[model samples]
Target: MTEKDIILTSEGREELEKELSNLINVIRPQVIEELVEARAQGDLSENADYDAARNRQAEVEARIKEIETMLSKAKIIEDSNNLNKEIKVGTTVTFQNLKTKKEMTVKIVGVIEADPFESKISNESPLAKAMLGKSTNDTCEVRELKEPYKILIKDIK
Candidate 1:
């Protein structure tokens, strides 16, 4: 079976790489040391420290494997300077709510890099989907809302 590609922004890929490095270079060694110290305590059957260390080791190893798999399937989304005035992934867009007249700016990114708190939205989101391929001054309908709101694209960068 073929593995599906995992989309990620450059920053997202860097974060994952940092995490993987920490797990391999720091956490893995720390867990190993903990296991050694726990084993030296003796009394194999009733050793709580040894049991806890083993559990922690399992968790760390599992996370390492998961991150490795994700990295292996990762497809980084590169920022483009020439998008032909169209809204797409890696584009920071400014839009004004037609009804409320409120303007907001958000960066469209892959799912892995989507953080609403950071004003980064996933391309798969309803608002982003409606805005994708649209040029500045175009109106888009947000279908996710109960009453679909219309937004006018003000700027793209």
Candidate 2:
């Protein structure tokens, strides 16, 4: 992917660390065991289990590499209590959609840890992109949906 530094919140960083540890200590050995078991079954050419295990192993290794790269390039966004200032990465912002009159709150986080379902949006996402650097009473436009939302930042924390 892009070489930009991977920005992560504290919780996101912890999740990544946990996944990395699991991959190295648990997944790698599990894949090795599968490969060994498959090999003991029979001829390579006719062995579906062996082929599948090999493919799984390759996928796991690739994922590990990607995680390692992310860790190496991680740029953690330190927690801030400066909510009186402008909204930024690691800030929880509250906004109201002018059209729908729907109010929502979201924590702006790094791309890898974004989960819109959980109200955690990526800093690079359109909504968070519009929110960043804005202050209370400032207007922003979010354009990810079919219809763009006109939002006013009501609060930042």
Candidate 3:
């Protein structure tokens, strides 16, 4: 499938930019210094420090590349500053299970900022897809492996 446009809010974008800056300015320099020190130790075949430093450099560069790519294709979404009574990105939504009486609070956010463990779901998730455009008091069903459950949108902020 084609990659969906990665959405990000201003704060999220700033976070990514800050991370990129840190990786480039601080981490990269530290890794380079470590590599220099490791190389000074001489034995190429048995240099664990050199190997580890090189590996870390590779990982850091890879992350820089990924971040650059994301920033290049970034499609920043407006935060909920002026949003009315609609469910949109940057909005904290609370839903309660109709049958099981379970409650979940999810913040719909850009794909990059999605952290399910933190209750931040991407707009592309099945639950977010069903919740979009839905208003308070509306019920939606989430189909999982075991059973389908219904959730009522209790509030949005």
Candidate 3 regions off by >4 Å? 1-4, 82-84
In model 1, the clashing pairs are: none
lDDT of 1 by residue, 1-157 (tens): 1487887878889999999999999999999999999999989799999999999999999999988988899888777684498888888999999999999999998877899999999988999999999999999899975789999999999
Q: List per-prediction Cα lDDT, in the order shown.
A: 0.90, 0.90, 0.88
Model 2, range 1-67, lDDT digits (tens) per residue? 7888999988888898899899989999999999999999989999999999999999999999998
Report the C-alpha lDDT of model 3 over 71-135, residue by residue, as the tens digit. 88888987755345678887889999889798889999988899989889988788888888888
> Candidate 1 at 6: error in angstroms?
1.1
TM-score of each: 0.89, 0.90, 0.90
With a 3 Å backbone cut-off (N, CA, C), the pairs that clash in candidate 3 are: none
Q: How does residue 105 of candidate 2 score in lDDT?
A: 96
